[model samples]
Target: MDTLSSTVQAWAGSAFAAVFRGIKVVRPQRPIHPKGIQLVGTMQRDDGERQPSGIPWLDTAGTNRVEARLSRSLGLPDAFPDILGLAVRFTEQDRLSDMLLATTGPTGIGRFVLRLRRDAAAAVFSSMMPYKSDTGPVLIAARTIESPGKLPVDPAAFRSLLGGESWTLELHHATPLGAWTRFGTLTLKLAKHAEDTAERFDPVLNPLPTAGTYGWTKRLREPSYAVARGRG
Candidate 1:
């Protein structure tokens, strides 16, 4: 991780540390999603057949325990019109699969352009965030069973759905770049609150579920996550 990008990553990491420490004296550094709710659930594989990505962790099949967090992107109140977040953590054996996603508006990230900056502009906005796969690049998204083809869900609706329903996380292969096709299904059962925990979700801490590199996205997030974790 010590190439030119890593150098930049280190600089970025330090910059974040400075800001985090500066803020620690007062409010504490939770950089993003400072306000959120944690939940416990399970990720069950869909019975439908899957096109192998040759990525063992992804193609390996089965149900697993899931720890999740749902929050407002701005750490706003439950009724505010802000991007909603869903971060799910899956652990099988000693390995971990964790993902953090923020709602990309009603139109989804498909309509947005990828901008590299030090703010929200750098954020990846897609119906599903992409990952490296043996076949190529892949992305994933979670959809409520109650709604079809609609997304960036409403706060009230999201709450109602979690009462007793499940969501389907669809994996897609990014062939032709953004032309994604179904690869697998990971069902997120209803979430229940997780109490008295301070775990932060940082994708860089874990290995990619598939092949290829998730470097750019991880680089973009590492600083922010470091800042958030520094709060404690």
Candidate 2:
């Protein structure tokens, strides 16, 4: 972006962060995922046959213990129309790698522009948000093995859709590298508590190999995270 646009975005991001902080003073426990369940799982990287992409996190093959959380974006009660979310966090060699996806389309740094039912079987989750990669701007995406079906509004069906099966999740490299490259397979095993309500998910804390938040991501997401953390 040019200087003028960049300046405007920075101002806007600060303003949004301020607004979020103001809200937190009143409702400190309110998180982006107000209503959700936590799970324990594993992320197994694909075999080393893939070419190196210069990003250390993606250029290797191995399985790591993962902590995942599933939730309705609005934190609404069950059976309501809300966006579904999957936040995965894992550690490799004592470093943390975090990725967040939602039941929204790929290719935007905006949020809630499109509202889709939280359907598990038919759900398509994208990094929806973008990141500034060492290679350039990129997003991640994942879907279930089952074919798309009728949208289910119930929580039980939604939980079954995600927890019931092993699914493939991918990291989409920017244009020159390619789109939708295999990242890993996520196999969630059991339900667990997140323990700390104050700890919210932030992509900025991502591992070095896959860390970056471009202009749009910062303007649109950082403020909310700041607000959630009472740092705004």
Candidate 3:
């Protein structure tokens, strides 16, 4: 996007951020996705030799401890459909990093569509926004691959499942209009005292290694992230 457009978006986003900050002030909790469960996992990143994502982290093969959180966007009742989110944090090249994903379509035009599902494990989780890479731009995506059954939306039930069973997800990278290419695998289980985990994931502030920030996409997000982090 052009600088002028980014500036305009920044202004509008800041206004929205102010409004959200006020809500958080009143409730003193997450501005969105207030209910969630923490997960601990291992991320096995594979170098995509065939379709390199142009991001060093994904292009380099390695394994890292991963921390993740799953939540309902609206904190809706367990039986109802609501947008779902997956927030992942890890270390890359010794620096803390994060990737925040939400339910979205998996292909072509659908990739732009935000989807809602009652079962968190059944929906595709996407970056929702693309990252500027050396190869141009790319989106990261994940979907449960070897789940035992449909995972409920309730944080309580979800935590129970996480305790006894391991959940696996295939990680992929794709251009906005291109096909997805596998780059990693994530296996998650419940962490000790996960219910008390209060870690925050912020891609805008703690972006993935070797990914471009301060670009058009980040401009659209910085305001809200700043406000949410109590920095604005």
Candidate 4:
């Protein structure tokens, strides 16, 4: 029985990895901080099912906050089939801007969403869906920023507070009925955070080729125009 269990575990792990194989982030856009970006959006799946949900990674506690509307008619390029749509917001406070990143998970496969917000002010929050399986606890690791008093805010400081160049969002799942478990790790980078600049704010989605892949090395690198132009 022990040997049988071990073999099953190994197979389950391999199967999980295989499902996530060759998943490359072909398009990575810069983070967009629109003045009135919407927080709630309707996600329309390829199967013609529309589900209303808050942007997974963003906070939507306010009543007057902006809302997002998504549809297949938006027509993302083929390279970004996994990402449905994104909505972001930036608030102008005093002389600084607070950034928020919100995105929906791939349609129809799994119901998942995420949001990230940052500002010179001291506050942060990250939440995920509550589901249980036989494996273990599924977890999403996130970071928050807070300063007791007024602090000099710099671009690098903001980026570092957001997890520097090597930050990532992890989706951890424990073993269910099988001997093995399943999980996914998505590496994220503060690709670009422009403030009071002439350049238009663009959000990039660079999916890693495989789970557990790192994006620190590429975060500082210039974003590929292929993604930017494709959306255009």
Candidate 5:
């Protein structure tokens, strides 16, 4: 049994290596300091047109969410502390437009709003505070003209990028310590816009049904009852 198990493990590893050969393994390069924060957000063009560059627009009606993890070393000096995670979501109508999410030392400072021109490039970053506050100021760490890239259509690549695997790799490489640290993976899923119904009134957006609700029995039973009751 042991020999069989080892052989299977070896075969699986070899298969994975072959499949992923020449594919770059994406992972965070830094230990995600308490002063450093990662930001991920989706933006859409207002005209309902997608730019030639590959960036997809997030639905305007749904809230855009952001997350960050911050951490600091403790008395044990050189070791890295456990990470604390923070997150926030804002919609287009929210007062916090043009804002950059910031994290400093296990805390989330309020977002800083900036002027951004359409078709222009921009970068948002979190900065450390010189003074103490519940939430500190995050300055512009870097900026550039917005040149979007093409969206990945491949299911495997897309899934790998969206999964938390990259973040997990970075955490594992970091030296564990006693101090409090911030660490978390941020994710963004774009929502589709709501449509107006035939009555000219907007219908409440229905949440996506769960897999359990999609059983064949449930689908068949519900329709049969409606038909029998003359309610279809």
Candidate 6:
């Protein structure tokens, strides 16, 4: 964006963030997606030879142990079609990395729009924003490949979705208006774990190798995330 528009966006976001920070000081809890389950899984990146993403780490092939979370954006009731979330955390050598996705349509412009879904299997999660690379901007996306069908909103039922079958999301990356290229896969299955978790994620703070945030992107997200971390 140009300087004028960018400046305005930054100013607006920072102001909102300051307000959120104040509120969080009073009652420190995640203002959104407060309820979620921690998941253990593996994330493997492919060679991506067909359509190279131009991101060095993403174009290479490797696998890493990952921790993830699945939650409703509003933490709404089980019967409602609330926007769902998938947050993945991993490490690249020494740097901790995170990528958070939300339910959105699977298309050109639709990829940037969040949608509501009653079934986890029915939702396609998008990063909702792009990460900057040397080539251009890239967006990451994930979708359930195992078709778990109706995912439960209740804690007990949501945990059950993992054990009986494989829960997998195909990981992909693309430019703002480019074709998506499959670069990896995230498979989350049943493993011994607690029902509630205190782990937190911040993509802006712990971005993947070869991917970083733009000034506007950081301005938009940094505030609320600081509040989430119990920081001002």
Pairs clashing within candidate 3? none
Clashes of each: 0, 0, 0, 21, 12, 0
Please rank every candidate by lDDT, starting with the best: 3, 6, 2, 1, 4, 5
Per lDDT, the best of the predicted structures is 3
Give the number of the best model, judged by TM-score: 3
State the lDDT of candidate 3 residue by residue for 77-168, as single tens digits: 78789899989899876799998999999998788788888887788999978888898888999999988788887877777666578899
- List, residue by residue over 102-172, the lDDT tens digit for candidate 2: 88654333332445565644666766555555666555666664333443535456445554444444444
lDDT of 5 by residue, 13-60 (tens): 454443333221221121122122233443322333321211112211
- Kindly list the per-residue Cα lDDT of model 4 for residues 1-232, writing each as its tens digit: 8667656655654443332231223212222221221122121112222221222221112211212211111223322222222222232222221221223322222224432223223221111222222232222222222233321123344334544333323222221121111132233334343322323322223321111211321231123222233331
Task: For model 5, give the 10-residue run with minimal summed lDDT.
Answer: 195-204
TM-score between candidate 3 and the true structure: 0.92
In model 6, residue pairs whose N, Cα or C atoms come closer than 3 Å (at least 3 residues apart or on different chains), thus clashing, are none
Q: Each prediction's Cα RMSD?
A: 6.0, 4.1, 1.8, 17.9, 23.3, 2.1
Name model 5 segments beyond 4 Å from true.
1-34, 42-78, 97-232
Report the candidate with higher TM-score, 3 versus 4: 3
Candidate 6 per-residue lDDT, tens place, 1-232, comes to 5988888877877787887766565546776777887778899988635677667888889999988888887767777878888888888888899889999988889998889887777688899788888788888898878746666655678777655566888998889878888888998865465776677888978987887678888878887787778665
Q: Is candidate 3 or candidate 6 better by TM-score?
A: 3
The 10-residue segment with the lowest total lDDT in model 3: 191-200
Q: Which candidate do you rate higher for lDDT, 1 or 5?
A: 1
TM-score head-to-head 2 vs 4, winner: 2
Candidate 6 lDDT for residue 4: 89
